[model samples]
Target: MADLHRQNEHGSRNRTRFPTQPTPSAPAPELRGHGLRLRPWDAECDTDVETWLRGNSDPEFRRWNTPVKLVDGMEDARESLRLRAEWDAEGKCVSYCVTDAATGAPLGHIGVNDIDHFIRTARVGYWVLPEARGHGVATRALRLAARWAFTNLGTHRLELGHALGHDASCRIAERCGFLYEGTLRGAMFDAGRHDAFRDVHLHARLATDPEPGEGEGKGE
Candidate 1:
């Protein structure tokens, strides 16, 4: 049989056009502060299927926030993992699983997306599991993530937006030191309201602003 590989002009075997494997990356660093720990997605151990499925399926969550579609089984979880990994690899977004510091159980999820390095800005979003709400989990996690974004990733401005009716989310943004900017009319899609579009309240925090006390790190 003829050789399957072709020789180039230099008389060396030419590599295949398509790679058989994905390029490896350095492991993402884990960020910890306050009462929470923020870790990169790890499907094997960190896949909180029940929490994810329930949180995303809530009609209130779907209406007030950009929600993940309902998930029914393992296949959906795997797809979610694949998409998250793609986002992390592309540097387009950095997502974290927020976990309790002492117990190591997942409390929720948070991320900074829409990264614009040229403008040194990004959009932040988060969701707390139903059981984890009312304990300030989102606020602490946001502060830790925001500090990392500003100090480590060179992000100068972080933006957060919530549906106008989400008073809890607005409070979390405020607790994390993000100032209310303005409202955008018909800027969001709310699924539970039978309305395709709804107004959103905008908030932002800048690197030059004072950091939230909850996330302040002790000198090491």
Candidate 2:
């Protein structure tokens, strides 16, 4: 297994080959699983992405996620575009916009962050839209993303961390086959306040782990 802490600061290897320009020529590749599909983020589909983010980033969702300040209409889409651009340039991290294959509508967002090519591991983070919650969108999205990372980027392990008290997220991690390694004390701050940070549960799925079945898998 690859070291999980190695950092990839330079874009020297394992770069993803995505077209610089948005192409409507073909539908985004579908990552099919238990009744779900995960695909790369499409700026052309910004309308859907914006709608999902705007509708879901309410106080309820913000309870866990860092507060997002949106400027005007479509700012979220613009930010998504910028992040993709960074992904292209950095050659390390990648993000995807999750959607329902049957309907091609946006359901959520997931990404591999803090990627370390030398170690061939990356951290996973995700959020599902309000209406799409409890329907296994996050699990499906995470499974697909992990598979892609391991297959395409030569990743050996995927790591996930969830705040303490996030029972739902903890369940997701366990269901997805991640081992609860341990937690970090005061590891993260939420909502701009340094609340007593709960022990973050760390979980990892190795490349040698059985190929994730085609279905909704879990990661917090």
Candidate 3:
């Protein structure tokens, strides 16, 4: 959410590395829980591209988050997916193409991005199709991604942020166990402009933190 998500590709910082704690290089595994399935996006699949395009272009999504590279067309969406695949291959990020478990119908997108193995931290971002909203999709997707990070990657912390005033995102993050951390003034590109700026509400969830509902985590 906000600029934190789109800027993750260039967010890697120069830091000391240890052989025993080398960065991850594993395939993103598919996860299923809470009535949904989370799998990697298929850059080659036309349906995936279509969904990506529609989601990114949705007015509500654009109003909240900012992409470093905007996806305005099918080609742009495909390229974004391709790059996401490359990042997944490098273990820099793990993005999921969220879908309905029963029907396999695409619902939205979620990602555990900018993995820093030395610190065992990552950023989480997501968006649900307009038609899929109000059904707890984002919350479930987030909890699933968090569980994967904590269990699989041993991630110490997972961060989530959204432009200020995005009450819906804040609630979703909190419902998934991401506690409100603070705000970063001018932390994101303003609503529809890249030059202007805006504040972001930061939230975080630590591996040691208690899961929201323990099992299958039900919520709004």
lDDT of candidates 1 onward, in order: 0.74, 0.67, 0.86
RMSD in Å for all candidates: 11.0, 6.0, 5.8
Per-residue CA lDDT of model 1 for 115-215, tens digit only, reads 76645779999887777777888888888888888877778899999888888888888878999999999987765544477889999999999866664
As a whole number from 0 to 100, the lDDT of residue 154 in candidate 3 is 75
TM-score of each: 0.79, 0.74, 0.87
Best by TM-score: 3
TM-score of 2: 0.74
Measured by TM-score, how close is model 3 to the native structure? 0.87
CA error at residue 78 for candidate 2, angstroms = 1.6
lDDT of 2 by residue, 1-220 (tens): 2242243344547755333221223333447765666766655666755754564455555666553453235766567556654664476567667778889777777877777665566899888777778887777777777777777667788999977788888777767777788888867666435554445778899989886545554332
Runs off by more than 4 Å, candidate 2: 1-30, 67-73, 194-198, 211-220
Deviating ranges (above 4 Å) for candidate 3: 1-25, 214-220
Write the candidate numbers in order of decreasing TM-score.
3, 1, 2
Candidate achieving the largest lDDT: 3
For the record, the alpha-carbon RMSD of candidate 2 to the native fold, in angstroms, is 6.0
